[model samples]
Target: MRRSTGHPRVRWSRRGAAGLVVLLALALLAGCAAGPSQRPPVAVRGELLPAAPPPPAAQAPADPDRLPEAEPLRSGPPFADCTDDVLAGLAAAGTPVPEGRTLRIGCGRLTVPADRNRPDLGPARLGLTKVTAPGAPADLPALVVLGDTGVDGSARAAARLAAQLPDPVLQRYQVIGMDRRGTGEDLLDCAPADARAALLDAGPERGDEAAMSALLERSRSIVQDCYLLLGGQLTSFKAAGSADDVEALRTTLGLARLNLIGVGDGADAAAGWVAGHPGAVGRVVLDGPGDPTLDEPARTEAVTAAAESAFDAFAGACATGPDCPLGPDPRASVRRLVDRLSGTALPVGDGDSLTAGATLRAVRTLLSQPSRWPELQTALAQADAGDGAGLARLLAPLGGPQGRFDAALATRCNDSRVRATPGEAAARAADWDERFPLFGVAAAQDLVACGPWPSGGQVAPATPQGSALPPVLVLGTAQDPRAPQSGAERTAEQLGNGRLVRWEGAGTGAYPRTPCVNAVVGRALLEGRAPAEPVVCPP
Candidate 1:
C-alpha cells in the first residue's frame, strides 16, 4: 500500500551522471552481452499466494450493482449534439472550445448516482475532459488515461501526448480523462475546518493498539462527517466504482473501440476496464504495473523482495565509494541502522525524537527510488553521527508539505485488499524483520494498515490473454526501486505484441528524458514497429 514518490525533478551532477553511465554499462553487460546461445528464456514458476479473505459479508458493496447505459455523449455539429452547459463550463474553466476545427475538445460535468445501483438518488458532479478526433470512420479508437496519483497531472499528460500525434492518428482517436469519484477537483469539501486538526492530534502513540484504534476512529469520523455535510452526495470511494465510471465515460464519449493507459493503481482500473468492457477495448498500456488480482500475501512478498534487492544494489554501490559513507561494510551498516531504529527511541532536536513510526516512514521514502540511494547514504551517515535531522527530512514528505497523510492512506487503502488480524499483523512484522533483516518489517506494517479499511474493491478478473493490438514498446530499468524491472518483463510477456526494452540504470524508464528511449517508443506507437533486439544504452 506504499505510494510511489513523485519523480525527482533534480538534475544529476557530473559525478552522479558518470556513476549512472557506469551503472548502465554494468546493467547492459549483465542483460545483453551474453549471446543467444548463452542466454536462455527464463520460465517463472509458482502459484500466486492466496488472497486475503474479503471483508465481512455484512458490509455493503463498495459500489452499486448496475450502472445506467446511455448513448455515447457528444458535443455539437462535428459531434452529435452540443450542450450549452457543457460549453459554459469549459469557458468558465478557461478551457478553449475551438471553433470550426475538425477536432473539438469539450468539457462537461456528469451526474452519476453516488451509488451506481441507485440512479433514482441524487448525483455527484464528476468532471470530465474529452478530446474528439475527426475522420470518417465507423469505429474510431479511444483511450482513457487513468491518473496514477493525481488527476490533473494525468489529464495534462494525456492531452500533451494526444496533441503530439499526427492528424490522421488524431482523427482516428479520442482520449478522455475522468476525475474519478472522490479526488482532484471532485474531492468532497464537506469536512469541517477542525477535521484536519482532530486527525493530526490522534496520531498513534508507540504503535499501541488503543492509540491506533483511536486514530482510525477519528479518521472514520472525519470521512463520515464530510459525507453528511455533502448531503450524502458522495458515498465511500473504491476502484471498482472507478472502473464503472470508465465504462460510463466510454459509453458517454461515443467511442466504438477503447484503449486504456493505467499507471500505478490506475493500472488496476485499466485491467478492470478491459475485464468489464471485454471486446470493446482495442489495447491497454499498464505502466508501473501492479496486478489487481494479487492477494495481500503475494503482494507483500513481491514488494518486500523487490525492496531488499534494490537496497542491496544501493549498498553495493555505497560500499565501493572511497569514503565509505555508512561504513566499510555498507550491508552491515544498513542492518545495524535498521536494528537500532526498530526498538530504541533516539532524541531529536526541539524535544522531538525518532520513534519506530518515524523510522518506518524514512525507510519507505528511501526505498521508493533507487536513484536516490546516494542521498540515502548521506542521510544514514548523518543519523549514525547522532543527528536524526536527515532522517526526519526524508520522512516529512510522507505527510506532505501541508501534513495531510489521509490522502495517501485513502488512495492506497481503496486500491488494495490486504490486511492483518491485529495479532497476525504484529507477527508478520516480526517475521519480516527476521527475513529481510533490513526492510521487511516496515513494509509488513504498512500493508497491515489497509486491513481495516471500510471500502475494499473487487479484484479485476485475471485474463492473461494478450491483445492483438499494435506492437507496444515496454521499458524497464534494471534498478528501479519501486516497480521492479521484472515487472516490466512480466507485462511485456503478457502483452500479445510487446517488445521488452531494458535500461540498466535507476528510476523508471527515461521516456520523457532519454531521447534514444523516446525515439524507439515513438516508432512503436507511430509506425507499429518494435526493435528486433533489446536497445542497450551505453554508459
Candidate 2:
C-alpha cells in the first residue's frame, strides 16, 4: 500500500491578475449561463484535442463481493492529522455546516502528483475529512462522499450528508470526504474588483448579437488565460486525474476496497475510478449523475425541459399553498416580473442591478434545492416590487472566485471532446428562449462558454466493464433542474451492475432526504444487495 507520514507546509503561488479577470467573467457567465455568440457555419477552435486513450478496462475482481466480514481494521502509515486545522479552515472559508451535529470530524491532506505522468511539475494536495458518529467502531468500512464539480467544499458536503444519514449506517462506516484539485489554499483568486463588478452589474441580454459576439470572445480569452496560468499543469485537473487521485487515496489508506457516494460531477470521478480500478470497488452510489453521451446541444435542451417542468411544479405548489407571494397565477406573475426586469434593471444595493437573466439563474439554483423554494418566491415578490436586494443576494453565491469557475470549466471541457460552433450555440439559445422562456436562454447560453476551452488530453466518461461487479445504486430526483431525471435513468442503465432508485420529489439529489429512499440506500450499502425491481419513493 502507498504510505505517507505527512506533507510539509507549502507556500502558495498566485497566478497573474489577467487569469483572475478571465476567471471572473467565466464564473459569472457560468452562473447566469448567458454568453456571446455569432451566426456562422464556422466552428471555432476552443479546446485543443490532444491524443489520449481511455484507461484500460480492468479484469473482474477475483472476489465479486469485496466487502469482508467484520474484522480488525489494518493500521498502515499515518496520513496528515490536520483535523482541527481543517475544521478551522472550513469555518474560515464560510462553508455551510449542518447545524447541531456531534459527529467526530477528522481532517488531513494528501499530496499527490500534479500529473502522475509528469512528476517533475511537483505535487498537488487533496484535502480530506473523516466524519464518524459517537461510539462508531474503529474497524468499520470507509465510505467516501464526493461533492459537485462547481464547489470546492466536499468535506462540508460530506458533513451535511453525514448529518442526514441514518444512525445505523453512520455507526457502521467511517464517512470520508476528499476535495478535488484546486481547492483550499490552491484556490486561484486574482480578479480585479472593478472587473468583477462590471460582469455582475451588467445585463446579460439574450439574443443580442453584440452580447453574443462578446461572450464568444470572452470564452476564448478565458481559455487562453487558463492555459497561460496553469500551462502543463492545466490538464492535471481533469476528471481522470481526480480518479487517479482517488485510487492513490485508497491505496494510501490501505483499504482493500473503498465504497463511494458521488454527487453530480463527483459521480463522474467515481465512475472513472470504477472503470480504471474495478478490483477496488465495494459499493457505489451515483446521485444525480449527468449523462455523458449527450453533446452540448442535446444536454442543454434536456436541462431546459427539466427546468421548465420544475418551475411549473414550483408554481403549482405556490398556487396551492397558503399566503403565496406569487398570487393566484404564479406563472403569469413570474413572466410579468421577468419582462419588467428585462426592460429595466431593478436597483439592488452596492450599484449592482438585478436583470432577468440573474433572476432566472437564481430561480434555477433555488429549484435545485427544494428547501429554499420559499426564498425564491420571496425574492421574486421583492423583485416585482422594485427591491432587487433579495435577488442580488441570491446571485452573489453563484458568482465570484469561490464558485471556482476556472476549475469547473477546465474539468468539464477536459472531460468531453464535444465542441459546438458559435452559430449552432446561439441558434439553440434562441430556440430555447421561444420554447422554455424562463430558463431556456440562460441554460442554453452555457453551450457557448466552453467553446474557447483548450481540450487536449480529455477523458470521455468511463464506460464500465465487467458484469460481475457489485451492484451500484443510482438515485434520481423527479424534478432535478440541473441534471434531469432522464439523464440519471440513462446513467443507471449505462453501468453494468447499476440499479435505479427514483425519488418523486423536487431537488438535485434524493439520498438522506426521504426515509423511503434512505432505506433503499441503507440496504444496498450494508447488505451488498439491491432490489430486483426498480424502486420509486413518493414525495
Best by TM-score: 2
What is the TM-score of each predicted model, taking all chains together? 0.58, 0.80
* Candidate 1 ranges with C-alpha deviation above 4 Å: 1-115, 118-147, 150-236, 245-260, 278-284, 317-354, 370-377, 383-394, 400-404, 416-418, 464-520, 530-539
* Ten-residue stretch with the least lDDT total in model 1: 9-18
For candidate 1, lDDT tens digit of each residue in 28-141?
334212112111122211111113321121221122211112112243112222234344433432333455434445444444445556443334445444565544342444
> What overall lDDT, based on C-alpha atoms, would model 2 receive against the true structure?
0.64
RMSD of each: 17.8, 10.3
lDDT of each residue in 1-539, candidate 2, tens digit only: 00012312111132221234335544543432212211112221112111343233244435533332222245422333344555554454343345665577765555666776764555665656678886667667788887775644566667667867887888888888887776443453322333223333333355555555655666666655445445566666666887887787676656666688988677767777776666667678888877756756677788778888889889988999998998999899988987877788777644456777667767776777666788889989988988878776666555542445455656766765667666766677678778987876665456666676665444334546543456678888888776788766777666665678888887677888899988888887777656666889998
The Cα RMSD in angstroms, rounded to one decimal, for candidate 1 relative to the true structure is: 17.8
In Å, residue 28's CA in model 1 sits off its true spot by 60
Candidate 1 has what TM-score? Answer: 0.58
For each candidate in the order shown, give its overall lDDT on alpha carbons.
0.49, 0.64
